[model samples]
Structures are given as C-alpha cells and as structure tokens.
Target: MDLILIRHPAVNIDAGICYGATDVPLLCDAAESARILGERLLALNVPPVKGGWHTSPLSRCRLLAEAIGHVHVDARLQELNFGSWEKRRWDGLDRALLDTWAADLDHSRAHGGESVAQLALRVSSWIDEISRDGRPVHAITHAGVIRVLTGQLLGVPRANVIQWPLDFGAIVWLRRVRGEWLLVRWNA
Candidate 1:
C-alpha cells in the first residue's frame, strides 16, 4: 500500500496568525492550485494516485481535491483545532501558556485547542478507515494531520514529529511492505 500526503496550498492569512480549525482560504484558488500541482505531481517519480481521494473539509484542501477529482471530505483529516486561538497572532499569544502547552506534548490543550493525543486519535481513525489496497492513498490535509499520520506510521515520537518542518503544498510519500510502513519521501 502507498499513502501520499499533500499539505494544502498556501493560504491568504498573514504570517504568525494561528489558524487550524478556522477555514482559511487559499492564496491560489483550488482550480489554480490543481493546475499547477498537477504538473508538479506528474513530474515527480511517485506512484500515480489511485483509490480514495481524501481531504480535510477546509476549503484550502477541499478545493484542491475537487479540482483534481472526486473528493471525500473528512473532518478527521482537518488541521489541529486551535479552539480559542483560531485567528490570534502567535506573537500575541500568552508566553507562559505557550510554554505550558509545550511542556506536555501529549495532553496539553494550551492556547485552547485539541490535545495532541486527540489529534492522534482522530488521524488514526482516518487511517483505519482508509482502504489498504496497493494503490496510493491520496489525501490533501493540514500539516498537523500529516505530521501525526506520519508519526504513527513510522513510530516517530510525538514530540519529535512536531519539529519536522513541513512546507505548504509539500508532498510526503510512504509505502507499506510486509505490513510495515516506511518513509519513501518527505517534504517533496
């Protein structure tokens, strides 16, 4: 089985603004992104996307998904919920609270949002829900969701997973062999 995880295209939001659950619009509309991305994906030496075409319900992801093909919008594929911090600038957020949240990587809801554990559970369920056929499982989702799913597949520690830089519109590829998932490519 192959899984292809693509981060949604860039958004129009300002830098440092905290947004996850909030539905942020893309800098380029879905069709435009798809037009550009289609060429890019075709150039890459990755497997052709087959089977499920899944995406987060956020327009940033859904739009791109729709442009490419039929889409399955699943809330579980959404970015981590920022709760009350939905649109606040990161610099404007409370420092102590940020530290408090950072202190507990597993369970803290600091900055008022879903815990990492909750995200793991949500992403895990999505993983379980997908078909495991040999075809690539394509999904357009948030960086947080992709990170969690990658961590789960590769057994990367939760705390370390967050440190991996994932760029907007990046593509991560993983393949399963002998019932084990291995990283084929990252941030492509």
Candidate 2:
C-alpha cells in the first residue's frame, strides 16, 4: 500500500509561534497551493490514491484537502497538542522547561502537551489501521504528525525524527509491503 502524507501550506501565524493543534488558517491561497501540489505529484508519477484522501480536522489542512478533491476529516490526524504553548512564541517559554523537554524527547510533557511517544503511538495506530485495508492512502496533515508517522514507519528514534525538516506543503511518500514499510520519497 502506498501512503502519501502532505503537510499543510504556510499558516497565517507569525513566525516562531507555537501553533500546534491551534486550528489556524492558511497563508497561501488554498486552491493555488493545491493546484501546484497536484502538478508536482503528477510530475512524480503519483496519481490520486485508490481510497479517498484524508485530512486533519484543522482548517489549515481541510481547506487544502477540499481544494484538491474529496476527503474525510480525522481528528487523529490533527497536529500535536501544544497545550499551554499554543500561540506563544517558543523563545518566550521558560528556558528550563524547554531544556527538560529536550532532554527527555520521548516522555517529557514539559510544555503540558502530548509527549513524543504519545504522538507516535496514535500515529502508529492510524498507520496500522489503514495498512490493513491494503489500499493506497493520502493524508493532508501537519508537519508534526507527518514526522511522527514517518518516524514510526521507519523505526527512527524520536530524537532523530526532529532532525527531519518538513517544509510547508511538503509530501512524504511511503509504501508498506509484506508488513514492512519503505520510504519511497520525502519532502517532495
């Protein structure tokens, strides 16, 4: 089964703000971004998935999904919950708390949000459920969700996954064959 994960386009929020799971709006024109993404996918020989596309319930993702075509919204695909950090600039947060979270990448909840392990578990569950159907799937979601899903699929450690920089509207492609997942393309 082929899995295509697309990150939402640039958001309207100012730079450096922690807007995870904040349900923000997109910065780019949804239709135009979708059109460009569609062309890029076509160039890569990626056709629409056999099953319909899936999107996070957030408008940032939902609008792009709608512009592309039909979609089913799933809350599980939503961005990691930043809790108290939502809408706050990262640099403005307590340095000690940030350090503590960084030290314990998998288990820390210093930001009062979902831990890396928690996000990974949920994303893994979604991958497991979708893989059972053996149909190609496309999901429009956040960078954090995509990172977690990709890390889970590739067996990458949580700390290492953070090194992967997924740009706005980036696409990551994966395929599951005989119970093993393989990365086909990334950041397309």
Candidate 3:
C-alpha cells in the first residue's frame, strides 16, 4: 500500500502566525499550485488523482483538492488544533508557555491546544484505518498532520519530529510492505 501526503499550498496568513486548524485561505492560486504539483507528481510516476483521494476540511487543503478533482473531505486530516493560539503571532505568545511546551512536547498542552501525543493518536488511527485496505491513497493535508503521520510511520522520536521541516505544497511518499511502513520519499 502506498500513501502520498501533500501539504497544502502557502496560506494567505502572515508568516509568523500560528494558524493550525484555522481554515485559512491560500496565498497562491490553488489551480496553479495544483497544476505544478500535478506535473511534479507525474514526473515521479505518481498520478495526481489516483486511488482514494482525501483532503482536510480546511479550505487551504480542500480548495486544492477540489482543483485537482474528486476527493473525500475528512476532519481527521486537519492540522493540530491550536486552541486559543489560533491566528496569534507565534512571537507574541508567552515565551514561558512556549518553553514549557517545548520542554515536554508529548504531554504539554501549554497553548491549551491538543498535545503532541493526542495528535499522534488521531493520525495513527487514520493511518491504521486507511492502510487496512491496501490501496494507494493521496491526501491533501497540513504540515502538522503530515509530521504526526510521518513520526508514527517512521518511529521518529516525538520531540524530534518537529525538525523535519516541510515546505508548502511538499509531498511525502510512504509504503506499507509486509505489514511494515516505510518512508519512500519526503518533502518532494
């Protein structure tokens, strides 16, 4: 089974804002971004609309998914909930709270948002459910969701998963072979 996770295009929000699960709009034209991404996927021998296509409900992802073609919208694919911090500039957030969360990435919910462990649980469950069918899948989701899924699939250390920086419109490929998940390509 193969899974291709594509992060949405750059959002319209400011660079330093924390907008996870905020349903923000795209900064780039969705159609153009999809076209470029489609070409790249084709070059890699990955069909742009292949198999069970899915997208996060947020417009940043959903708009691209619609531009690409048919896709099932799922809330499970949404980014980590940032709670009160949504739309707030990261630099303006309380430094002490940020440090506390950074100190315990897995357990801390310092922003009053979902903890790293909680996000991992939901993403892992989605992975499990989808992998059961042994079908190829393309998902238009967020960076946080992609990070959690990658960490769960690759057995990445919880604290270090954030280091795997993914740019807007990045694509990650994974495969499940003989009941084991393996990373095929990342940030493509």
- lDDT of every predicted structure (CA atoms): 0.88, 0.88, 0.87
User: What pairs collide in candidate 3?
Assistant: none
Can you tell me which runs of candidate 3 are displaced by over 4 Å? Answer: 47-51
Model 2 segments beyond 4 Å from truth? none
Query: Residues 1-188, candidate 1, lDDT per residue (tens digit)?
Result: 88889999999999999998999889987888888878877888767766547999999999899999988889999998978888999999889988998899679998668998999999999888784446678999999999988999999997888889999999998889888999988998
The whole-model C-alpha lDDT of candidate 1 against the native structure comes to 0.88
lDDT of 2: 0.88
Please list all clashing residue pairs in model 1, or write none if there are none.
none
Deviation (Å) of 116 in candidate 2: 1.3
Steric overlap count per candidate: 0, 0, 0
Quote the lDDT for 116 in model 1: 87
Per-residue alpha-carbon lDDT of model 3 for 1-188, expressed as tens digits?
Answer: 88999999998877899999788889989999989988989888864455547899999999999998888888889899888889999999999999998899888999898998888888887877877777798999998899888888888886677789899999999888887889988999
lDDT of 1 at 128: 83
The 10 consecutive residues of candidate 1 with the worst lDDT sum are: 128-137
What TM-score, computed on C-alpha atoms, does each candidate reach?
0.96, 0.96, 0.95
In terms of lDDT, model 3 sits at 0.87
